[model samples]
Target chain A: MFEKLDPLLHSQLRLAVMSLLVGVKEAEFNYIKEKTGATAGNLSVQLNKLKDADYISITKEIVGSYPRTTCKVLPKGRKAFSEYVNALSSYIHPNGNE
Target chain B: MNDAQKQLEMIHEMMNKSQREFQSASFYYLFWGWLVFISALVHYLLLTQTNFTHPYAVWATMPIAGIISGIYAAKQQKSSKVKTYIDEAIGSLWLIVAFAFFGLIAMAPALGIDKVYPFLILLYGIGTATTGKITGFKLLYISGLLTFPLAVASAYMNFDNQLLVLALAIFISYIIPGHLLKKKELQMANSDA
Candidate 1:
């Protein structure tokens, strides 16, 4: 009776990341990590999953001597986020459909 | 029901607790608020009390303010990794205001300096009110809207008196709203920690 929540955003850490990026123009990997409280390795894996799905685009660049990774939510990601929210709302509300 | 509810709860909390969202918004308002206030006061004093040929020269301080703003922006960029929609909207709004400020200044000679404060106050009203409305900060919106009347009042006043009106406008619009925003930011940060 309910649409499926986008599995890519269904997880805690990834949803946290998308929630942040969904509002911002873009965010650095470290910033997302700090906010999500996800270990670098775990966040990297999840981020890559999102990237592969074209939900987000990650750019790695050398700023000064260090590399900076910035992630942006593409149109698909934003659409997916809204869909996820709507699906979740309906799923949780139960009687909303009626 | 259970899992979906948990997920929804998480989304709500994360959005609320987003680290340091628009943290420095208050600082700029406060800084520019006082700066304009002081400049306008000095402008009045010079025009009224002193024999200084160029009362307008006091505005030279803006270049220094510009430098400070640039440095502040760079520091903010360095410290912050996320740029929220509010940040983007406020940033673009002020950028446009900056250009319009210059445009008005360029036209000042044609309009006469006495006539310029009304337009400048109008600009101030636009920047603050728009920023407030978009961000849903009530202090900014109400204070910003209050400046419109001041702008109109300044239009009727003489040159030296216009400076006083301008000073009042800055106090209400920028100084008050900036401080309020700053206080709210600190409170939110404290709650987060």
Candidate 2:
């Protein structure tokens, strides 16, 4: 039997954001946009969704008179991402142990 | 492929891409490496070539250069759009090393200046090796490994000879690796452009 993937992370863009965040301490809004090739509006919406879910934390601060938005994956988010990956692996390789 | 398999691939791809895109400002390494190199050489010269009795005074360069480097690093970090886990880890590691240096300096009077170089070299070794492990850079790992024996050798040498060993260790462990890192950063920046 396959485990259910987290709906929050099932989307292409959301998963991509989580994947990027998983490797970094924190990333700026522009950095994530560049990496994901997603529109700023779309990325902001997805990021907000993750932030609301407590899967990530978003901080807005001024850097050299410019407002910068940085996102970091929370422990909850890391755990969820790992579980999601495990579920995906289980589905892909049913005979293999997670 | 099924959706699950596709998602798995996507995750892997995104992570790999993010890792690849990561770039550090190589200026800091270059700045400190040269500063230390010059300082050590000048210190050695003052101790041997000149009538200068205060060879230790040359170490004043470290604090001055450190202040400048700290300011530059802050500016760079402020401007940077992303900070990686590796960056944070390396930053923390160096912070610890810096404190250790300070602690060693305070204890130098009791431990004697001659005994300090070996411990300082060992700290350099630890810092460089851990940095290599974190970045998966082999040159830095090898440089770090080389410092261990140099540190041991320094223990058996006189102060003047130990200065030369420190100079050689810094050249191998910091300057060379620093230049390579700068080259890598430039290549990454150019490729991005």
Listed models, DockQ each: 0.64, 0.78
TM-score to true structure, per model: 0.89, 0.93
User: Tens digit of lDDT per residue, candidate 2, span A1-98?
Assistant: 87888999989999999999998888999999998999999999999999999999999998768899999999999999999998889888888855
Distance (Å) between predicted and true CA of B42, model 2?
Answer: 1.2
Interface RMSD of each: 1.9, 1.2
For A20-60, candidate 1 gives per-residue lDDT tens digits of: 78877788898888888899999999999999999999999
Show the colliding residue pairs in model 1: none
Give the best candidate by TM-score.
2
lDDT of 1 by residue, B1-193 (tens): 8988888788877777553376478778889999999999999999999999999898899989999998998878766777777788788899999999999989999989878879999999999999888888888999999999999988998988989989999999999888888889888879867
Candidate 2 reaches a DockQ of: 0.78
Kindly list the per-residue Cα lDDT of model 2 for residues B77-138, writing each as its tens digit: 88888887777788899899999999998998998988998999888888988888888989
